[model samples]
Target: MKQDSFSGRATQGSFFEGLFVRSLQASGPFAEELRACGYDPHHPKAIYPIEVWNAALEVAWRRCYTGWTREAAYREMGRQLALGFLQTWMGKVVDMGLTMLGPDRLMARIPSLLALDTFRYELKVQPLGPHQYRVSIRNDPDAKPELIAGLLEAGLGRTGVKPTATVVMHREQDFDIDVTW
Candidate 1:
């Protein structure tokens, strides 16, 4: 028999739990937004795919905290959670390439998705050395420095599976990001 690793178990939890905690009501504003974007709310379960959900995870990580200090790291977690939740929804909204609606309308919504408050932030990748990258971010001014860096390290290290990205946050903005992709 094969052994189930801790990382594998955690990933499973992130997805399954994320589905319920991440699902948008089919009868609420979210559903309407989906329809407007070419998604069928009545058949949401069938329309949304696992790949889209996975993509949400990708977007969320990018919005996570980063800083030269620890405080910034902890504060960024909150932003990450909030942004991740919304991206997960939008990813589901257009995951099927707007099959339920016209592609032009779908294309029009692309800017809207990018406009989703959570994704309004920017991320820049700078090569530190050869295989190393330095990720710097500009986020909420009230955020602490130490915690932000720690969180960036933890989040990126886990996401990239190489434990190698260095992150930093600037204490003068509301944007958060991951320097390592």
Candidate 2:
């Protein structure tokens, strides 16, 4: 895959970038590292390099949490991302829809929602039961399953269910996520 194949749309990047900058300004403890990544968070909606996005995330993790592992950072980032999403108008709409539908129904709509996003992969969601689901993504070798798992769990939480997600890698560029509540 090309290095920038996973690059996301500028609007998506802006959402994360804005939150990152605001967090840093609010004493996130990784301002310098994030700045050194060289992508201006203040850029209006425009295509951004995926490398910079991932690098910013790494910098935040390393500089902000001195003793944490990458996995721990990812988990926390995911939680923060979920909360951040709720702060935006679009996010609020999605959150309200998800809450109204509840977790199971929301899981069923995940693939379609992902499709509308700028993620560079094909997504498939399958329901195993009322409280179990399987989500598979293809052609995304660099997929951050931890972040995604956090997002899934957080989304389910909004619907009053405690959810757990287990990710399994299969060959190259394939991820299978098993979710249960």
Candidate 3:
């Protein structure tokens, strides 16, 4: 038998921000779906399985993004989550004096950050140039490739990188994202 995309683990900080802080932006029906999935945005747990996060992402994508494609919606959700993360105490701690590293260096450190904040979906960033990078994600993949792309964009934007762009080549077992700023 085959497992689904939800067969992994997710962090309370990063993944929940994608749903509660960024996607839903309100209290109501979506809250019930999250509750049914064993998550309550009002009182969240420390870590949730990827299935719960995926459920929350689905509710957000369907509810908050009416006119957008699934991938686009997820990408925006990812972006919002990144932006939201920037405003948190942890984000402040992570960003404390780290901005001097600039976007490229920060991009390379994504693997460690993912390990800390996410349980599933691993990303490896390989620099192709001073301002260009090849990002590949393995393990249990969730959402579209653009979701991570959006995250990179948002993170890069904070580092004073002008015009961060991520182009997804295609969707295989992993996501190949070409990021440049």
Top candidate by TM-score: 3
The TM-scores of all predictions, comma-separated, are 0.29, 0.80, 0.83
Candidate 1 ranges beyond 4 A from true positions: 1-122, 138-160, 164-166, 174-181
* lDDT (tens digit, per residue) of candidate 2 on 52-114: 567767877776656988877776677677767666666778777877898888898887765
- What TM-score does structure 3 among the candidates reach? 0.83
Whole-model lDDT per candidate? 0.35, 0.67, 0.68
Better of 1 and 2 by lDDT: 2
What tens digits encode model 3's per-residue C-alpha lDDT throughout 70-152?
Answer: 88987887788777766666676776645787876787787776552355566678888868888887754553677777777
- In order of lDDT, best first, we have 3, 2, 1
> Model 3: clashing residue pairs?
none
lDDT value for model 2: 0.67
